[model samples]
Target: MSTLQSQSKIEEANKELVRSFTRTVFVDHRPDRAVEFFDPKGKWHGGNFGTVEGAQNIAGLLTAVVGGLPDIRATEQDIIVKDDTVVVRLVVEGTHKGNLLGFPATNRRVRWDAIDMYKIKNGKIMDDWASEDGVKILADIGAYTPPWMKSGN
Candidate 1:
């Protein structure tokens, strides 16, 4: 297969993985069932609290985090496929129904824009780097006070 074709296949697989996680895993809170979406030795980076390596660790984190969300949606804004990699721009919308990161449930709808870059090898996702608008989510829930908001913009 040509390089472009290979890239496209990887991108498609990555998209399916994302869809599976959003619909089946996140919505159902089935973290233990997410082995299909990640490599056994995969790593997740840039999650603010810490980096998680290995499927077990990631699964544990997901279980804890998803326990509180009554509803969650991950919407892809764009996807770019390159050789052995797929980059996705996404918006994560969720409602907090339980405590998270030391904050109690406000039942607030949180919307965070995120960018996720996935590395694929042998048609499976090997690793990922993600960055999300954590500040915006916190500010929206009044948990954060931006320094620049002194003038109340």
Candidate 2:
């Protein structure tokens, strides 16, 4: 195979892998199940809480989120792949059934937008930057209290 053909093959493989990861890990109830798809030094950056490295740490985070949104589903709205980079936009839908961020379960169904960018290396995802609208989620679950509604404010 030629060099261009090899690169094209790699990109195709990466695209397929990302789609599988989305459905099996992000969409399904078990994000950690895609452990093999991540590099040993893989890092998932959540912006505020810092980077989460290692499969175990990522799994813990996923598990915690699932604790609150027991029926979470990450429905991929768009996926773009190029070379070693993959970008995905997801509509995360879930139901509040357990405490989250110190708020009691409200049994509310929520749909939130999430975008994730991944750096693929050696056929594994070595880095990820993820962003989600959190304040909106809290409000959807009736967890956010306005300053005017607070006792001291």
Candidate 3:
């Protein structure tokens, strides 16, 4: 195969790897399976949540999310892959069944968008940077009152 063909093949494989990982961990609600996709020292850069190091810590974060939204489902809106990187735009929907971000259970359904970029190495995720629509999520769950919704305005 030519160099260009080999590069394209690698990119496709990386994209598939990310898709599989997302299916196993988020869509399947199996945070315990994170170790299968993440590198031993994988790092997750979660905006506002700080940087989480190690696959176990990343899994812990996922566990918390699943705990709060037991029925959470992530639907991929877009996916872009190049070489060792994969970026996914996702629409996440769930019910607030348990505490999340220090907010008590609201039992409200919420939908939000998120974009995550992952760096793959040796078929494992070595780093991930995630950005989510926190304000919308909080508003949907009644955790945040918008300025326009405030009384005496």
Candidate 4:
């Protein structure tokens, strides 16, 4: 095969790997399987939430999220693959059934959009940058009070 074809195949494989990982961890609610798709030293840069290093640490983060939103699921709206990177835009939906970020359970349904980019190496995720709509999630969960809702206003 030509070099271009081989590179395209590699990108396709990477995209598949990311799709499987997203399905297993978010849609399938299987955080325990996350480590299988991550490199031993994989790092996750979660915007606002800060960074989490190591495959186990990343898996732990997912576990905590799942704990808070037991019924959480992500629907992929867009996916882009280039070289060793894969970017996915998703809409995440869930119900707050347990404590999260020090906020008590609200039992409210929440939906937010997110974009995640992953770098693949040797068929495993080496790095991930995640951006989520935190403000919307907080508002949906009744955890945030908008300025207009303040009594002084």
State each candidate's clash count: 0, 0, 0, 0
- Across 50-137, the per-residue lDDT of candidate 4 in tens digits comes to 9999999999999999889999999999999999999999999999998877788999999999999999999999999999998888
| Candidate 4 residue pairs in backbone clash | none
Consecutive 10-residue window with the lowest summed lDDT within model 4: 143-152
lDDT of 2 by residue, 1-153 (tens): 999999889988988877887777656677667577788778889886578998667767777778888888887888888889989898988899988766789999978899999899988888889898877687789878656656877
Local error of candidate 1 at 38, Å?
1.1
Candidate 4: which stretches are off by over 4 Å?
148-153
| TM-score per candidate, chains pooled | 0.82, 0.86, 0.93, 0.94
Descending-TM-score candidate ranking: 4, 3, 2, 1
- Itemize residue pairs with steric clashes in candidate 2: none
Measured by lDDT, the strongest candidate is: 4
What ranges in model 2 sit over 4 Å off?
145-153
For residue 97, give model 4's deviation from the true position in Å.
0.4
Model 3 agreement with the true structure over 1-153: per-residue lDDT tens digits: 999999999999999988998898778999878888899999999888789999998898888888899999999999999889999999999999998988889999989999999999999999999998888888999989889878999
Superior candidate under lDDT, 1 versus 2: 2
lDDT of 1 by residue, 52-83 (tens): 88878777777766765657667778887666
Q: All models: lDDT?
A: 0.75, 0.82, 0.91, 0.93
